[model samples]
Target: MAAEQRKLLEQLMGADQLIGTGAQGRNAQLSITDNKVCRSYLVGTCPHDLFTNTKQDLGPCSKVHSEGLKTEYETASSAEKAKWGFDFDYMRDMQKYIDDCDRRIDTAQRRLEKTPDEIRQTNNLLKQIADLNSTINTGLLEVSVLGETGSVAMAMNEMHKVRTAKHQKETAERDLKNLQDTSGPSGHQKLQVCDVCGAYLSRLDNDRRLADHFFGKMHMGYSDMRKTWKKLSVELKGRAPPVRHHEEEDPYSAGPRSGRNQRYGGSGGGSGGYRRRGRW
Candidate 1:
């Protein structure tokens, strides 16, 4: 494990990396992979910045999202970017993430089909719990009354009923807990998968939480990935001519001038000066 940790990824030389070889400010002069910088952000967008506090939250990024390093990466020439191939590397990594999220979205859709509205299931569970509790209470009362009447066997039998009801109640409680976990943290809402990241969001959530979902990092990160893919997939991979660039060409330029005029001379009645030329 220590040996694995010692391995470093290929890294671009940063301004701060000048302090190499047992230097103070150079990440303890350790392996290149030991840098505190976040490679994902350095190459492009970092997934860590997205889906914060949501179900798909990836937790905080382990490395720093240094703006200076990001700027340097962006300003580098196309040749340099091609040499590094960070764009395509990030693309593959993000392709896996997107593919996984797509699967989750599909699964969530099937789950939604089965569940429809989970709140209704929750209500049913609650009703079952209430019925079970009522049975337990009634059994306990019967047990106590039978004991008072000196019916020892009947009281023991009634106690058995109470025990069975209690066991059923426990099972129902665990089921309810699992349902709530899937439904929402608040425990009363219907769940829907986010189209962007496939994390479950509450259908009954308020504006505040909804806004958070829209603006949150994980959702936004996937959104960024899509936008980047639209461009980089063609640019980095060298596919068809970029339609975006093609669409930006000036639309109103003068077309080619060719042979169109006749060779006839001017009219005799003050109607003409020079004869029309095909090249004019």
Candidate 2:
């Protein structure tokens, strides 16, 4: 197994034009033909060409090099899947879910940090209001005790400060509550993992987004693929694959013309990988 993996790595390194030593030691050379065909392109993070909107000295990607790299990837992926009992597609889907979860958790943590500051600010404002109320009461008592109108103006000023501070305190408290509610583990916007497709879902997602996600092409396609994989696994045990009824058409199944657009819950042309609108 080790020898096989080593051979596969060597073939990949040679086929992918990864021959040069870089800062990270031996690394793949950048392609110099079409940037769209690079390995990073498959992950939707390619920064070459117009994608970065910069005129860097990055070279082009050779068509031949790109094809060879793709072939090597497919070959290695097939072997890896056979060894791991899962395909590259499934791995990519799970990775996307993980990335999404990380992003959400980061956001939630940031929000959670801000909540303490908000609570402190609100408490300070409340204290100010309370002090102002006491001042106003003291001023009013002075006016009544001395039977003079001189302290009435001072009491009115304190009342105004109390009103303003009360308003600010209310606003801050509301914000703090919202942050705590949403940033807490049991928050409405808490992170959720979809069991079917292994995707990260937001608890605060609206009806439309939830519907789109549930009915989205990528989610549905992955679900179908999982079912198919299970069926195939069962059949591989010296039994024929079960036949499906003609009426039981998978709505998420893509045809030849479906293209990559199908992966985004849209109808268009392109190949595999999670082809979502914002992320792959």
Candidate 3:
């Protein structure tokens, strides 16, 4: 029964452990396999490692590496480390932008289906306006040919109808233009994806949110983390293990040497040494 319950719990949770091995270890491993080095280390800024006596909070790398790789990383030159650090965040952001574009395209396609109906409505309005115009022209001609003051009143009524139809037609055309601009191939509101975080960027002239978004902490942090992982991975794979430098020293001078004066000191003054006068 206990086994069954455990199995059920595992199924519900989808995994045996909620959290895997810590971020630092995972990232360290990934740094080796991915051939991307950690960015923090490249700039002489990485504070966490096996040798470091501090808390580890950094997350795992998307790639893979192992513990033995750390020594190779430490031996690499600063210039080499820098070369490994690439803009990984930018790639992630670009992927996000691509996703946004797909969604926008989907939405635009749905709205595009309604465009035909809008165009049809506009055409109907134009036809109505044309008919009204014809009626007004015909009425004016009748009044002019007859020279009848009573017919002038009839022409004025037709003129009023023409004006109303023209106004309605104009309104329809305006609506049609708006719809096309929003969902058409040549839309005024073009979309741009963020290079840092994959968020949809507005192309509106008045939108100033892009400036603020680029400076957001989330974007910068993700970028930095990605860069670190890339650098770590590359450095681990490309560089050889760090060579341990052993300094050569004279065995006699390994520790403090006995001074000539101390070795010669004695109880009284002599050719061999000086000695204390009180001691026999």
- Among these predictions, the greatest lDDT belongs to 1
- TM-scores for the candidates: 0.42, 0.27, 0.34
lDDT of 1: 0.58
TM-score of 3: 0.34
lDDT of 1 at 228: 67
- Candidate 2: count of backbone clashes, pairs at least 3 residues apart or interchain: 12
- Model 1 root-mean-square deviation: 21.7
lDDT comparing candidate 2 with the true structure = 0.43
1-280, model 1: which lDDT tens digit per residue?
A: 5422222211244334433432565553332122355556767766655555566767555555455567777898976655544554355445556667777777765665535467788888899999999999999999989999999999999899899999999998998888876654334357666766666777677989888877877777777776665555555433221111232221111221111001011211111111221110
How would you encode candidate 3's per-residue C-alpha lDDT over 136-238 as one tens digit per residue?
A: 5765576565455566666666666656756765776676567656653335355544443334445663536755655655445434544443443343443
Q: Which ten residues in a row have the lowest lDDT in candidate 1?
A: 256-265
Q: RMSD of each candidate? A: 21.7, 16.2, 25.8
Writing each residue's lDDT as its tens digit, candidate 2 over 1-280 gives 8645543554567434433322232334432222223433332222222112222213332322244444444566544434422222222233343344345545544543435655676577566656655655665565465445566666566556656655665675666566556654445466555544445677778889898878865556445544443443333333221223343212123333123123322221112222232222
